[model samples]
Target: MRLYKIMIVDDEAEVRQAIARKIDWRAVGFEIVADAENGRDALEKAETLELDVVLTDIKMPFMDGLELGAELARRKPNLKLIVFSGFDEFEYAKEAIKLNVVEYVLKPVNAAELTAILDRVRGTLDAEIEQRRNIRQLTQAYQESLPLLREKFLLDLLRGPMDPQVLEAQAERFGLAVREGAYKVAAVCDIVHGGEGRPALSDELVPVSVRQMLSDALWDRCGSEIVLGVPSILVATAWERDPVESLMRLLGEVCTECKRILGVTLAVGIGRPCQSLAELCRSCAEARTALEYRAVVGLGKPIYIQDMERLDRTAPEWDGHREQQLLSVIKFGTREQIAAMVDKLLSDGEGEWSDQSRVLGILGTLLSILRRCRLGEEAMLGPRGSWIKLLAEDAPMEALRDWLLSVCLNMSGCMDQRRVSTAKRLVEEAERYIREHYPDSGLSVDRLCEHLHISQSYFSTIFKQETGRSYVQYLTDVRMEHAVELLRATDDKTYMVAEKVGYDEPNYFSYVFKKRFGVSP
Candidate 1:
């Protein structure tokens, strides 16, 4: 078992030495880490060293025992305090209770009483240490489940009309690097069979190999997130500038390299760049559309949607069957699913103003669904009967489709706000936990998540997303801040300062200190 460190303080060196020698501290699971001649000296040492218990006299030179105990209690709420005074005054005892001193005794301390106090502190610390171990185990298990969570998140991002706020929050929780830039999504389709004949390769291994190749190529790129897609490997790339030419070149090389090295031909569909992740679904849809043209564009090629000349086909004739399907999806499907159905419903009808009746029918059905859900027309369309004026405005078919999508998404947002609120609350609770428990050296992702009753992967992702820093980084920053404060206030050695701030290893603390502040502790 790890020993609990104890500090002794009194005005006289003789009294301090006598208390230090009175008990066999090590035999009783305590170590005399330091001794101070006065309350002032003890407070300075206590600020520097990580102490579990303090044995002190009530009356001392610069500061009294109750004052020292109050300061220690404020600085380290977990520290156990023992105050000894010759006076049996009621005021002193009342003050000890206010300061939360653990033990009170007459001066010329008794060895047996001190030993009992040390034992109680040890038991308390041991229980806490065991709880921390359990937290570590829970956190480790949660971490092991992250791969599946990541895959799910990536799938959602692809099939998205995800709220941009939620998207960024979830992305951060998953440790994905997202920024404001040109975002384009690429889909990698395996053509080993479609290219020539099926290669003598395992179907699973093919995607695994392709994903690895994509990672290797993308490692130095601006920023990228890749996941094994349903039928293709999906990659989302963010570049600081328009990367149309650069993306084509890189994916074209990936296709060639796959065929040359693995004897597998790959067809890559590149989407047009958009300004934000919110527009990735549109880009993703376009990429899938480009892949469909591989029959005419040729197999085993990298297809860019921007380079395609789409045929000016008219919107499909809406039948009773299609209208019901759209209504059903609008009522219950995800925002992505609803937008996709709407996009298909509006396609090729760009200049067909005569299709206004069909558009109105779709909007009417949506308004009815909102009404069924107990939502007012104004809640979705911004005014009680403004949808009529909107239709009368003679908007383009594409613009009308976008407006319809917004109506469907507005309802979905109402249904989904509960989840967003939950995520925000979880983040708030986590930040509070970290700030309060930074002194515990074992404070970690597992411990924090366990406290929040959440999975490690989720807490890790959302914490990073909300704070823009990983848990480990954030904890280190908290520790470093306290370390700096102690260094500035007292002449404590580097190792003592390290102990005070939760680092077990002084050298490691110095390394982190220098990295964060450009100077050693």
Candidate 2:
């Protein structure tokens, strides 16, 4: 709706005036804002005026249009420039292109040709403005609705046992398209330990930005867009093309790049390929299952689902005794006791068992207990303690039990030196907080900021910089881990566990839990 301001620069006043008068500028939504008789004068005017397009003659006193154009470009990259030259020289045209001039017209320009050039430049400017606006809108929307969109995306991908068509349609709606073929899901895990005195990793792992880079990289390599389901990066490519190998290599490269460029550590787990979108849920499950092996496998390493042997049915079923023991160690045991128990479990070698599955199961059970305990505490502590309700949730006991065992098994292997001690310590501190006060409904960034005696922005930046995770993400991880515990150890309803974990809304809680574990809580 606004008029584009145009500027004309030429050595001769007649030439500049003649060209300006020839065009019906108003009809084309343009206004001739200024005229300069030389390049030096043109440069001065460009700096002073907010001009959209500059038409200049190549030859001028004091400053040649070429030099002036170059300087203008340096000062304002977004400024559109057009050059007119008496000499039809290829060198001048090439220089104009290098300076990113919008167009080059010869002296005594044909009216029709000049009009066509103007039309083309106008179209380009319009498109650029539109793209910028779209990007802004999308970015704003994403920022305001991040938590909700993230939960929904992960829920749809991990839970819902949905039909293949439905899944594909969902992907399409999100602007993610995958070809019909084998696909694998990858979970990127960043661990932050308290008392590490190191920078947080959150700034380095902005899901949207990371997704954009990954999508661009994958699209360039495979000619298809990468479907990003946060914490989970999904790539759909042909098995014959060796999508797994490609994915592993890509993740490895990405990790190395992040470390080199951003000073961050990342662990990636890749699930086996699923033939159809319906089976993608399983793939999601496998990727999360692999994350439990972080300690043993080492951080910043890529773990593949196929690398892990399938669970043997002949193994002894996980009993409540071990679950209770693990829970006790987590709840009240000393660090040494917990460490020793973890080491013993890792070395026990349950023989080709579903180690990943077991860890998720244990986490689920522990979270459930924590949730219930928090809920009861809330009742006793009154409204001030009611905050705990925000982090509690009800999950499927059977599925959670299975997931906990996998988590425990996986964690047992993680006690090695490869898992940075500082990172581990920070994670421990954060975990402790989640366990003790998850029921606090007011447990949020503002409260945490006040408690830490830091600005919210700085606290958020530092927390993410150190942990490689946002506060919400880390909290969700802890809560979901507890959800798995509840799902296994009790007959409590799913919604109840959801509430117990501090989730006021069961549906939203389930969505978040499922996204984390690749199965409905």
Native-to-model Cα distance after best TM-score fit, residue 144 in candidate 2, in Å: 9.9
lDDT of candidate model 2 versus the reference: 0.57
What is the per-residue lDDT of model 2 for residues 422-498, given as tens digits with 9 covering 90 to 100? 33444455556766778664577556644543333334433666778877777777778777888999999988998
| Alpha carbon lDDT of each predicted model | 0.67, 0.57
In the range 1-521, model 1's lDDT, one tens digit per residue, is 56888888887888778778888978889888899877756876775576778888887765788788887765555577877788665365656557547667775578898778777777876764444334344355435533887789877887657888888888878877545455555454545544556643456456665665666566666587777776777778888876655566566556655664456887677776778777776666556655644543456556765444222122112134555566456545777898887776655467333477778777766665555445567777887557677788887777788788888788767644533555678888887888888877677665776576544434555576778977777888889889989999999999899888887768667766886889776
For model 2, the stretches where C-alpha displacement exceeds 4 angstroms are 1-154, 168-175, 183-185, 189-205, 223-240, 310-521
List the candidates' TM-scores in order. 0.33, 0.34
The candidate that wins on lDDT is 1
